[model samples]
Target: MTQRNSSFPLTRRAALAVLTSALAFGAAPRVALSSSPLDVVATTGMIADAAMRIGGTRANVRALMGPGVDPHSYRQTRSDIVAMTRADLVLWHGLYLEAQMEQFLADLGRKREVVAVADALPEDLLLSHADYAGRHDPHVWMVPTLWAQVLEGIPDLLAAQRPEAAEDFAANWAAHKTELAELDSYGSDVLSRVPEGQRVLLTAHDAFGYFGRAYGFEVIGIQGISTESEAGLNRIGELVDLLVERGIRAVFVESSVSDRNIRALVEGAGARGHEVGIGGELFSDAMGVPGTYEGTYLGMIDHNVTVIAGALGADVDPRGRLGKLATGS
Candidate 1:
C-alpha cells in the first residue's frame, strides 16, 4: 500500500461515531435547503453519479476528480479545497483508493460531514489484496452487486442532514439497486459467452479484480491495484510471454491510466510472434464525459462488458443490453 503524505487519521472508524451520533440524534449540520441546493463534493465520478441519483433535486454535486483523473495519485488543488470546504456534504471512495488524498479527507471529516461510501461495505465480503496483509481492494464498483452495497451508505449519510428527503433517497437507491442487479446479470450472461479458456482480461492496472471475479474471467494487470505502483520491465516481459503462450488476442487500456505499458505488451508479444491487438479503452478509475451515456455507473460497466465480450469473441449485442451504448462500442 502507498503511504499517506500527511499526518492525520486515515480510516472511516475514526469518524464513524461522529456520523452515527448525528444520525441518531438528528443534530448533524444540515445542508442549507432553504435558498440554495445542497452543495456536494465527491472524490470521483462514480460517487458523483451516486450522489446525483440519490440526492435528486435536493443537491448539487461536484466531482473533485474528473474523467481520466487517476484517484490513486490525485492531489487536491486549491480549487478542490475551496469546493470541499464550501460544500454541504463530501463523499469519497474510502479503502485507500484515493491514496494521496486520504489524510486530507480524514482531516476534513473532523470539521464537516464527510462519508466514505465504500467503507460501509462488510469486511467479510471484500477482497483482500495479495500484497497488503489486511487492506481491501478499493475498486468495489467493478462488481455491480458489490457496488450496490456501497449505495446503502450514501443515502444514510445524505439523510443525516436532509431528513426530509430521506424517503426519496431510499426509493432512488432501491431502484438503482434493481438496475445494478440486472447489470450484474447482464455482465455474467454476456461474459460467459467467451470460452472459459479465452476469458482473460488484461489491463493497464489491477482495477478489475472484482469484475473478473464476478464474471468468471482471469484478470491480469501490468501494474498493481494502485496506478501509483510501477509496472516493471520484468512484469511486462512475463505478460508478453503469457499473451504469446495463451494466444490472447486483446489487451485493454484504461482511460485514467496511461496506455504506454499496454502498447509495450502488444509490441513485445509481436516480437515473440504473437499478434495481439489493443482491445479497447476501458473506463476503470473514471467514467466517460459528464453528459454521455458512458458517464453513468451503469453505462461505464455496460461499455466495459460490451467491449470485453466483443473482443474476446462473445456474441453480445453491439448496442448494450439496455440499448444505450454509444455507436462504435
Candidate 2:
C-alpha cells in the first residue's frame, strides 16, 4: 500500500476547548430561535441524515457538503461560514475527516454549539490512518454497527440544546438504531453469499476499511486514506500486477473520487491479459443524490453490499435490500 505524509494542526486540547466553550455558551445569542425549529448544520450528509432522523420535527438540518462533494478537500465557502456562525447547533465528523475545515470549525466552535460527533467513539473500534500517524480513519459510516456506536452520543447532544425535546430525541434515536441494526443484518447476510476467495474489495481510495473489516474482506485502495494523496506510477504498476496475479475480476470507482486511477488499473490489467471490469460505482466519501434512497446512509451501504456481492459472483437483488435503490444505480 502507498502512504502519504500529512499533518493536522488541531490538537485534542483545541477540540476539547471548543466543546467546553460551546457548552458554556449553549445556543449562541446570534441565533434567534424563539419557538422555531432548532437551526442545525452538519458538515457531511451522513451526519445531516442522522441529525434529521434523531431531531425529527424539532430541528431543521442543513448539510454543508452535499451529494458528490468530497469533504477531504472541501473548504468552507463564505456562505458556509455564515451558516455555521448563525446555526444554533453545528455537527461535524471529527477525526480529521474534514481535513481542510478543521481549523475553521475549531474557531467557529467558540461562538456556536459545535460538536464533533465521531470523535467520541472508542479508539479500539477505529482503524488507524495509514497516511497520518496517531489519527484514525474517518470513514466509520461505512459500517452500520460502528456508525450506530457513533450515534449513541448524539441524542444527548441534541438534548443538551433542547431539554424539552429530550424524550422525543431519545425515542427517535431508538427507532433509528433499530433500523441501523436491520441494515447491519442485511449486510452480513447478503455479503456472506460472496465466495470466500472473491471477497476482495478494491476501490478508488481507502474509504472502506471499516466495511472490509466488518465483512471479513481484503480491501485495497489505489490512493491512500485521504483523496488528497497522489497515486504514483509505481503504486499503479504494483496494483496491476496484484490484480493479474490474484485473478481479481473487478475494481470499483467512488462517486466523489476521480475514476482516472481506477481506469488506469483496468487498462494496465487488460494489457496483461486479465480482463477486469468495473464492479460498480460505490458511494465512498459521498453518497448518491439528495432526496433519493441512495442518498441516505442505509441506501448507501445497501447499494455497496448489493453491488459488491453481485459483481463478485454472489446472487443479490438488483433493487437492493429495501427495494428502494434504483435499478442499475
Query: On residues 1-329, what C-alpha lDDT tens digit does candidate 1 reach at each position?
Result: 24553423555566777878877887655523352457899999999998898888878999988889999999999999999998899999999899899999999999888888987898888887786556788899998889988877888877777777889889988888889999999998999899878899999999988988788889988998888779899999999999999989999999999999999999999998889998898999999998999999999999999899988998888788789998663
Off by over 4 Å in 1: 1-36
Model 2 C-alpha lDDT per residue in residues 169-261, reported as the tens digit of each score: 999999999999999999998999999989999999999889989999999999988998899999999999999999999999999999999
Which candidate achieves the best lDDT against the true structure?
Answer: 2
- TM for every model, in the order presented, reads 0.88, 0.89
Model 2 weakest 10-residue run by lDDT: 1-10
Clash count for each candidate, listed in order shown: 0, 0
**Residue 310, model 1: Cα distance from true site in angstroms:** 0.8
